[model samples]
Target: MMNRRYVPDLPEQNALSEANFLRLEKLLGGLKNSHYDFQWFGRNNEPVQVHAEIIERFKFTSTVNLIKQNSALPKPMDRVQLTIRMYHDARMAEVVTWDSGRQLSGVYPYPNDRMYQIDEKAQANVFLGEWLAHLLRHGVAEREWTPS
Candidate 1:
């Protein structure tokens, strides 16, 4: 169970997030069926296969973590995680990245950069697609993360 302090308690927001979660679940389910895989090149130029799988889904949020293929990395790197935070307002939903057991920045994908807002109109599928792509592209080049 997650700590109450970490879980948002807004009822309406939770509903919105739930809807987003459903959409995300559908999206990821499709990806899994298609056998879509993301590749991240390590500092040593070795390729790390990244697989997306849903770990948990709640009323107000959902979690999708990337599993490193062949157990090529350690705990956190072995699984890059993200959370979807639902909102009641027009902003809809927000996706937050987590690493090393800490939230890097809410709704901001890039690490070590100024935190910015995700597009308010973006749906869960699009948000996730872009985020995964960003991870593959910048995570290695800018974040100095090597596949373990």
Candidate 2:
């Protein structure tokens, strides 16, 4: 799965890249029903484990035109916008506000309040795995993802 970091710059691609989106479309189109295991640590410092099955995977167009698109409105929000064609399966991807470096947000699932409570490294790993699994489920190839 191509990590969000490795995804081509969205502005450069305009709306969405057909090649990458098509890759995902073809991959998910083949799957019937399959549960993929994912693991992570919790805010209480415990392990979070779950299995999400592949129901359907497809591409959708979304945008975060400005930094404030991430802002929580009432409060300052820190986040990163991953522009790509994504899926809507059993596990719904959510907006996660985390403190990767300076307080930042991401298009995964996590909250800011507990950001300090969870094991950052472990959670990051788990998040990465889930992100990768989502990509692989859709047949997207893996690529090195680095923060900008």
Candidate 3:
């Protein structure tokens, strides 16, 4: 288990560095069934919380309200919700944008919304492991994640 805390200011150069992504990938790869809760400061200093689960696949649900930081407050009109899905087989990992509040257009199989694939060998920006690592490193967590 690794620390899941929000880092307000991280180095721009290492925003999503390969090393960081590798660390994240290793952490999640060892898990079976688990729930991870994270809290972090988003852009504009808004508090954001991400609830992630690891079952057959990895799912992340994030919520943020630009108008209010308190969770008890009424749902804000400017609330933003994002969902990400990562599915892995024996050969590669595929990441998909399950849902997003920012997109104003069509349904799930959108033309621009294509599944990103990452193979075993680390390539340029196509590494899903690295991407997940970056998210875990920057995304705030309520506590360290422990696999069940």
By lDDT, the best candidate is 1
Superior candidate under TM-score, 2 versus 3: 3
lDDT of candidate 2 over 28-118, digit per residue (tens) = 3433334333344434554333333333334532211111122222234223322222333312222123322333322223445544423
Candidates' C-alpha lDDT: 0.45, 0.32, 0.39
Off by over 4 Å in 1: 1-27, 30-46, 67-93, 104-148
lDDT of 3 by residue, 1-148 (tens): 9945433222431343334334434544444426666565666666666555554443432221111133533566333333323223212232332233342222222224453222111232234344355456676556645655
- Ranking by TM-score, best first? 3, 1, 2
- Steric overlap count per candidate: 0, 5, 2
Residue 64: error of model 1 in Å?
1.5
How far residue 32's Cα lies from its native spot in candidate 1, in Å, is 8.8
**Better candidate number, 1 or 3, judged by TM-score:** 3
TM-score of candidate 1 versus the correct structure, residues matched by position: 0.33
Per-candidate TM-scores read 0.33, 0.22, 0.37
- Leading candidate by TM-score: 3
lDDT of 1 by residue, 42-95 (tens): 656767665554445455443455444425566545654455443333324445
- Superposed by TM-score, candidate 1 places the C-alpha of residue 15 at a distance from the truth, in angstroms, of 19
